[model samples]
Target: MDAVRPLPDFLVKRYQGWKATTYADNRGWYKRLAEEGQRPRAMVISCCDSRVHVTSIFGADQGEFFIHRNIANLVPPYEPDGDHHGTSAAIEYAVTSLRVGHLIVLGHSGCGGVEGCYQMCEGRAPHLEEKTSFVGRWMDILRPGYERLAAGNEADRMRALEKASVMVSLENLLTFPFVTKAVEDGLLTLHGLWTHIGEGGLETYDPAAGGFVAV
Candidate 1:
């Protein structure tokens, strides 16, 4: 506590002033969001990493989007019962209840989960109970991607793994009954996106092109 930095009084006062200055627009914003009840047209599937915030990247405010986040932003192949379907539940809620028109799988660079998969394959990490380390289990989803990438040169393998993971997630998204129904009915469109944290580059899935193209 003694070594902790204290807030600058000037900055604190400035923050207080900022509220009053921006009050006109913000005063009813929360209430408006509550009343509107998140009529978002799009649902974003993104990583749970602290660094990758979908709302901040999209410049979206409350009720603007429905979002689901998980390790590597993965959409697991739908399997009923036993397993908790956090991402699927969100997807079902968004697609069925909210009727979102778009579902985006947002991938990013330097992903810890992706890296963990690589490490796990190399026998660098093992399951440790009560530790919450996912190197062993989470990597199961990316096993195919890792194998495909490992067949290539080191540099290419990394890039391929990241891209392939996104592709796999897209495929998995289809396993959900609601998602499949929505897509079949032409009520929903699925997209894959790769984001570079440092460069801020965006690559969007182009089904016609059969690859991710810059967007």
Candidate 2:
């Protein structure tokens, strides 16, 4: 704890400015949110990449989305072994307790985690193959998707794997009993989204079309 340093002046200054403006403009909204607690309608599973901003992209307000971010925006199959499961815990809380109506798995271009999986599966990243690497282990959840796309062009395969990561997460979400029940009862809906970082183009998955379409 002692090793922690104070925040930079630029961050502090910007935060002060933002805080002042936010309170000055939406004082009542802030008060209501603080007093009533959050009732988010959607739970967003997104990447840890700083470039993918859920709020900014969706123009969301505070307390609108319950968000969880991890490497590759991946979700593993439901494993109730009683060990630490951050993402699973978040999903459970969102679905069972918060009763969020929508669960979104968001993927994006040039994902380092997906790229790492591509390298690891291709026998290039030895560190990731090791038992000690956390990122390697996390990206392992996307390996099946990578394998499924192995027959295509290398570049296209990587992009396919990135999109498939969202598919994988969506499939795994159904493995949870509570999630399955909620979804079956029409209490929850799932969505998949992929974005182009540079161009800001977004594509949504269409089950009928079996691919992403411009949204």
Candidate 3:
């Protein structure tokens, strides 16, 4: 077995810098969080893309929002087959345990996961179609969204698929009975959001508009 190594020097240095500045400045807040525990009011499910900075986007402080990141920011249908389900577990914890008031699915432009799903659906990504590929299986959750994509050029379709992924996640959230009850009793609200990576622009899903409108 290979021996585990310590963190890279750059990361160590960055952590030291943050500890001296941000952590030092917010020492009391950190202590309070540790003593009181997290009581985040909202939960955000977003893409694992490095550029999708959920905290910076919302100007949120530490321990403010329960954030979960996955490839393409997808949510699978409720399943209790005694298997490992990371995303579902997080949702259950946030909705039932933490009892967050709002759950947001945040999708982003130029998502590699979404692009891969598009290629796979179009029969261009054979590697992702392989049965052994974990990414392929995980991205399968977005297949329905891909099928619902409207007619458009490749770029437009990709953008639409990105948004559709958020909608799909929102739909799947309701598949969880706890989420449905919370939403029905007005304890929780669901939101779908898409953001442009380059422009830093955000749009929210409006059921009345039946499309994304700038926010």
TM-score of each: 0.83, 0.98, 0.98
Regions of candidate 2 where Cα sits further than 4 Å from its true position? none
Candidate 1 stretches greater than 4 Å from native:
1-24, 127-135
Model 2 C-alpha lDDT per residue in residues 36-110, reported as the tens digit of each score: 999999999999999999999999999999999999999999999999999999999999999999999999999
Candidate topping lDDT? 3
Model 1 C-alpha lDDT per residue in residues 1-215, reported as the tens digit of each score: 78898799999998889777765568798678778777997999888888887887888876788888888888778888877778788988999999999999999888888877776776766662224755456658877777766476655666767787898889888888889999999999999999988898889989899888999
Each candidate: what lDDT?
0.82, 0.95, 0.96
Backbone clashes in model 3, listed as residue pairs: none
Question: Which scores better on lDDT, 2 or 3?
Answer: 3
Instruction: List all candidate RMSDs to the true structure.
Output: 4.3, 0.9, 0.9
